[model samples]
Target: MVAHSAAKKDTGGGRESGSDAWKNYMRRQTITINYGRELPLAQGVEFKI
Candidate 1:
C-alpha cells in the first residue's frame, strides 16, 4: 500500500511548503520445504531455497 501527501516550505527558518510526500508499506512472505530422493521429480516443479 502507498499514500501520498504534500507539505509547504516557508521562506523563513520554518518547515518547507511542499505537499509532495509519499508513504509506502510492503508485505512479504516466505516458505520452506524438504524433498526426498524417493519422490519423483516433476517436469514443472519450481524449487526455492
Candidate 2:
C-alpha cells in the first residue's frame, strides 16, 4: 500500500541521452513479507517427526 504522485519532467533524449531535468521528487514504495516456522524435510531420517 504505497501511493505517490506528481511526475512529468524529463528533457533528455539527445547529446548522448542524459538528463532527468531535475525531476521534482516522486516516490512511493512498500514491501512487507512475513514468514516464520518451517522445519520438515523428511521426518523419518531420525528426525522423529
Candidate 3:
C-alpha cells in the first residue's frame, strides 16, 4: 500500500546529490494507481498501474 506524508527538506548528499533538490523540498503527495480489470484474480491481483 502507498502511504502519503510530508517530505523533509534535503541537505543534499549521497545518491540524491545530482538529483533535483526541489523534488525533496516539495510537500508529500498521494497518487492512487489503478490496475482496472486487467488482474487475473476475481479480487484483482498482479495488475499494475
Candidate 4:
C-alpha cells in the first residue's frame, strides 16, 4: 500500500491527493484487519506494523 501510494504520488496524482487516497484506502483495509487499538494516524504509520 505504501509503495502504491508513493507511486501514485509521482504518477497518478500529486502528493496530497495520492496520500489522501492512500489514507482512505488504509482506513478501509484496516477496518477489516480488526486491530484492537485506535489507529496511530499522526503519520499514518505503525498500525500496519
Candidate 5:
C-alpha cells in the first residue's frame, strides 16, 4: 500500500507517484508469485509521507 498527503495547492503529483509505486509493486509481486516465491522483493509497502 501507498500513503501520501498533499497540500491543497499541490498538483496531485503525490497521488500519481503513489499510484505508480503501487503498480510497480504489484507487478513485482505477480512475477515473484509466478516464480513460486512466497515473498516479494518489497514485502511491505511504499510510504510517501
Candidate 6:
C-alpha cells in the first residue's frame, strides 16, 4: 500500500489578495510474486507452483 498527497494553488484575479489552496489524497497497491522456476503463463488458466 502506498499513500500520496498533492497540493494545488490557484491565484484569483481582479483585486484578490490571497490564493486558493486545494489538497488531494490518494492510495495505491501493488503485488509481487517470486517464482522458483521459469514457466509459461497461459491466459484463462491456473498454474500450480
Candidate No. with top lDDT = 4
Kindly give the number of clashing pairs for every candidate: 9, 0, 0, 0, 0, 0
Give the TM-score of each candidate. Answer: 0.18, 0.14, 0.16, 0.43, 0.45, 0.15
lDDT to native, each model: 0.30, 0.26, 0.33, 0.69, 0.61, 0.26
The TM-score leader among the candidates is 5
lDDT of 1 by residue, 1-49 (tens): 1112222223332333221221111111111122444236654676565
Number of clashes found in candidate 1: 9
Model 1 ranges off by over 4 Å: 1-34, 38-40
lDDT of 5 by residue, 1-49 (tens): 3233343125556666667776898999898677555436546865355
Q: Give the TM-score of candidate 3.
A: 0.16
| lDDT (10s digit) by residue, model 6, range 1-49 | 0111122223223223222211111111111222222234545556665
- Candidate 2's TM-score: 0.14
Error of 1 at 9 (Å): 66
Off by over 4 Å in 5: 1-13, 37-49
lDDT per residue as tens, model 2, 1-49: 0122122223323432222322222111111111112225434545333
Model 4 worst lDDT window (10 residues): 34-43
Residue 43 local lDDT, model 6:
50
lDDT of 3 by residue, 1-49 (tens): 1111222224333345424444543422212222233333446344354
- Give the least accurate 10-residue stretch of model 3, judged by summed lDDT: 1-10
**Model with the higher lDDT, candidate 1 or 4:** 4
Model 6 misplaced stretches (Cα beyond 4 Å)? 1-41
